[model samples]
Target: MDQQGQNGLMRTFREPWRSRGALAYVVAALLTGFYVVLYWTEWLTPAAVALGLRSKWLLYGALYSVAMVGGAAYYLRHHGNSRYNRVRIAVNVGVQVALAFLLPLIMPLFGGPEAYLSYFWPLSYDKLWPSTLSSLPVYLALYFIVGSLLVAPLLAYRYGKRWYCSWVCGCGGLANTFGDPWRHLTASSTRSWRFEKVSVHTVMFVAVLTTFLLVLDAATDGATGTFHWLVAGGQWWSVKQLYGLVVGAILAGVVGVGFYPLFGPRLWCRNFCPMAAMLGLFQKLGRFRIAVKKDMCISCGNCTTYCEMGIDVRSYAQSNQSFTRAACVGCGMCAHVCPRGVLRLENAPREQADKARVRLPVVDL
Candidate 1:
């Protein structure tokens, strides 16, 4: 344990991983580029190397597959440290955010006669056109693509979602990495269960409503994508503000969950996340989730204490109910922190005929 022994041990451990980072970049870039080609195949009039009009899931499956196998290989070889998925994280959010603001709508910020401004949203049929609104399927697929292909695995695979939010997500990482001073935003959650109930429910409803109205507006005119760019310098200004709002929400969670780990666990996940609200749907239908057994239960609140989403893990562990709650993020904090090996992660629930079988109390049958 002396400094010299520690130094020798560190040296021994550091050498084998000679810039795994660089190779990860190369691989993610190539894989992303391959998906891009797959995406553009519909427009490739010549039908060159046609993937032949497959199901959307097939394409997503391919993307997810590449990300998984590649991510797993990295996971097995690397420690589950911050360094493991840096490449994938950077490429994932980097490409998405850059395209979000820097594409056609970006106006030069320096030459403005009036105040400088920027745009955050995109244009109609210009870039990710379907984001504005179209068919229900396209509309539904909008955030699904953002979360599933982009966000989910980034959270689920190696390090977890906190890593994704903290490191890779440009907007998320900003408040997380630099806005510590503004940590007060999220810390304001109510301690009273009743108040927490009202506030969290209100926030969730409002977010969903705002999103719905915004989508309805865009879909109605086929112009929502084009609206932000109407004024030349307006978009980037909007982007600055929008990114702040997104970060503010994250701040709420971080302060509620990350900083105040002792007072309680993750406040945002339990109370505020609209995205988690949406993810919970798939989580209900999701092939994967966490599981628990009654015999191993210790009645300790360790899992509940650490949960960012704020479910009472100890309660579920004590009952016959499934652990895969709709709101569960599957962040694995509960699994990692469980001292008695009482909590576990697992798959989706199975469907049954007419009605799912339910056990009832005996009444002298």
Candidate 2:
């Protein structure tokens, strides 16, 4: 290539906002907002609650997404957010506890079946439908068996990261969301990078294994366990319910360090994200993935530091394939930062891994 052409290409490569993680922030907000609105407005359900679509997970995803964004926003406001650690914890437990007490009151408003909230019992949640879920052993058999075979498999297949476990139907996102700000304090290894890597890979393994276990258990109609006994007294202060309140000063301090002090409010996304584990599992068998390119590459490693998940996009960026790991959030921060315009997030078929000698610069990474 002519020097003029080379120079022009080099000139096009430099964009600083990519390094600043500007787009990551943008995408996160947009997604958070998208789901928040959907749930808040009931935008998904039709005029037919009798069809049972109202209780589907899209609604739960929206509800949980609101919880996550709330956690991030909360951590961002409280500087070094160790300050808000207890407050955030309180908010989460309080919301759930309140919901427990309130669901009974709230259900009448919805004109739904009246159900009892077990305050301190083994059954965490139970809704007594107007009729039994199934009358016969075979029909009852489907309840347990289909739990794993149908709902679990379909949910896993549809949203790779156990979206139900993380953002969609996630109950833990309430806690994990607050965890972001405290990430650095919980940075266990002297090797921050290593600590981050081990945690994600570990969770990725657990996520896949557990997700499959859930599927298997559901399919087998096995009666797995739940901890509904934690809801003592039907309010926040009962002994069991109180156990949910302890968010640990150490953990809270970790949030303050990671999000409030060090990275943006999602630092724990690196060290302790089981949601990633679930997502990572789904990601492997799933359709979409981040595509990377190496040949036209200049290795100015901006994408690595910007990763809230602590994924080294630079390593992936230097490759010619879609990163098969589940950790990649499909967050396009890497593609947004390429100096040589070598990175991109593509849904190209797996067979098309190397068709582009030089891929276009992704503006929306």
Candidate 3:
């Protein structure tokens, strides 16, 4: 491309306020206002309860609506109309709508749960034993067997973390769309990366350990012994008070969203999300990767600048290496912002050891 073309392209990416990204911010703001009014007027209660919407549903709906619509609008305008982005928006909105409102309202009439449908939370490990002890085996089945054991591995194998983190998760959906602007806040330093690796994985380990103890306590029917000393009212204090109330409500609900301007949109996902850590474990063994073509790379740093996970994407591209970072949520911002189209997300064979190895591209949409 000519100098003029390169300059224009750079300007379009750098000054996103001059492009469709600004429109997304406007749409998000408008929708947020509408939602706030709906809640302030107490209209959300009727609209939601009448439709059998649970608390989770309200969150899911607002997030899905804003993220999908606004995100799609922005991507369609400036990101070359990729099929992946289009289908990602559609699937995210459709699935959230179904899970949040339609299914909960419809299924209960046929004798489902009186409050809400059973949606699995993959990293909610502490819930497993309580579920089994309460004889609500369904929760165990859904959260552990279906979500953690089955769906997670399948998705990791097929598409790394993209299936959940980018396309389906409410948290990820929020980050991808509403959090797009604040993505630059992600710390790109190697020290930050080291801290991220330790913190998130530590959370995952704690989750697993807590779950194991809870299950053990449940099995013994809460006998007062060494186990009690070890667990120490773990079921109520740890799971209910700490994990459910504190982590779920305060950390994820409040700090995660509220700290967007201060610490980037992915503060939770990048630092404290146990589910991400669990998925990243499987992702390390997955065939999927983002391959960088060094010949096409211009070292413009657009890829790294847009990387929400703080991976040095430009370095990877310059060195002709494939990105195998386990923390990658696969939001596609790096690939989308690349002017030279040097990077591609693909499934390389396991036998391919070299960082420069190329493979057939895979479009997640």
Candidate 4:
């Protein structure tokens, strides 16, 4: 194996845990079972009490932070030689520990609402709901509203979804860290890409529709009786409850983390995340792109293999096509693993990107 990429011949296929063997299945089963019990049952309540935690959620947060920290160590051990990888992973873990977990845990102690400051609407799902916003403190409500509607999209437009997906989102942090080992398992086939494009945007549309209905119900004071009942009337079959059960619990929790061993870390982000879908739209309209150097690619598969988002990076690199794909999370792994230094992540002006898209022969360079 050539020693050019950051990861050199991991023998991923030879390892049972990484290669979808029996151990991988077992791990997936355990993870699925854990989430099922956590979301649907109070089986873990006793364990949370024994740990002196107020609720199972806090206990889960502690465990989540620990997992990210442990996984970060493992990730850094393998990819830490690059300054970019080290800093990005460190900041990601820090955001998970501090903003996502600890701050929410500590806020209620000071007579404040327990809120995930790091999360915003669509992904947070309930953050934009009128009832949820009314329940929160005014500042926190504004934070979620403004952050979701303005700040988040603006950031995605300026810096790409990586600003959140790679550097701050707990989901992405966990994927990059704990899920790093099985990244090569992410299906990069054309069929998978087509499925991803359809499924992700469908979920995004559903999310927007759900939120719109909830707001309309609240605004009309339930005059839209059927819509109100169907959307948020506290019934199990209601849209809110169904979405929570299907999208939030089943997709995000159960299948997302649980299937990591078999399907790779980004099962949720790549195929189902409404937030990623929305951000990706803004990202495509923005500046972030992976610029490929002409005549430099060696056709090695490292970039495609390690892309958690299932992007066919080698195709773009080999063609010297400096481009932005809506699905790209801008994780920078393609550049990190490029043997010939053929790939670069950039936020250049649209004119420059347009110019670069015109292919040139090696002699012209």
Best by TM-score: 4
Report the error of model 4 at residue 59, Å. 1.0
Residue pair clashes in candidate 3: none
Query: What would the TM-scores of all predictions be?
Result: 0.41, 0.41, 0.76, 0.95
Q: Which stretches of candidate 2 lie over 4 Å from their true place?
A: 1-108, 111-159, 162-190, 197-260, 339-341, 347-349, 352-365
| lDDT tens digits by residue: candidate 4, 1-365 | 23344654457688898999999999999999999999999988899899888889988888889989998988877777788888999999999999978898889999999899888879999999989999998999999999999999999999989999999899999999988888888898877887999999999999999899889889999897787889898999899889889999999999999999999999999999999999999998898888889898888777887888888788777786888888888888888877788888888777665655653222100
Query: What does the lDDT read for residue 154 in candidate 3?
Result: 79
Model 4 vs truth, CA RMSD: 3.7
Backbone N/Cα/C clashes per model = 12, 15, 0, 0
Error of 2 at 235 (Å): 16
RMSD of 1: 15.9
Cα lDDT tens digits for candidate 3, 1-365 = 23211223345335544333655456445644554454335655656666556554564555556565675565445542566766776676566566644665566577665322223443444435564436544653465556666777778877898788887776776776666656766777877887889988887777677677777776787796766656745455644345554556555656666565455678888888888888888887787788777688998887776777877787778767776778888877788678788888887765455534553232111
Alpha-carbon shift of residue 301 in model 1 (angstroms): 2.9
Q: lDDT by residue for model 2 over 71-102, one digit each (tens)?
A: 65653343222322334344444544344334
After the best TM-score superposition of candidate 3, give how far the Cα of residue 298 lies from its true spot, in angstroms. 0.9
lDDT of each: 0.40, 0.41, 0.65, 0.87
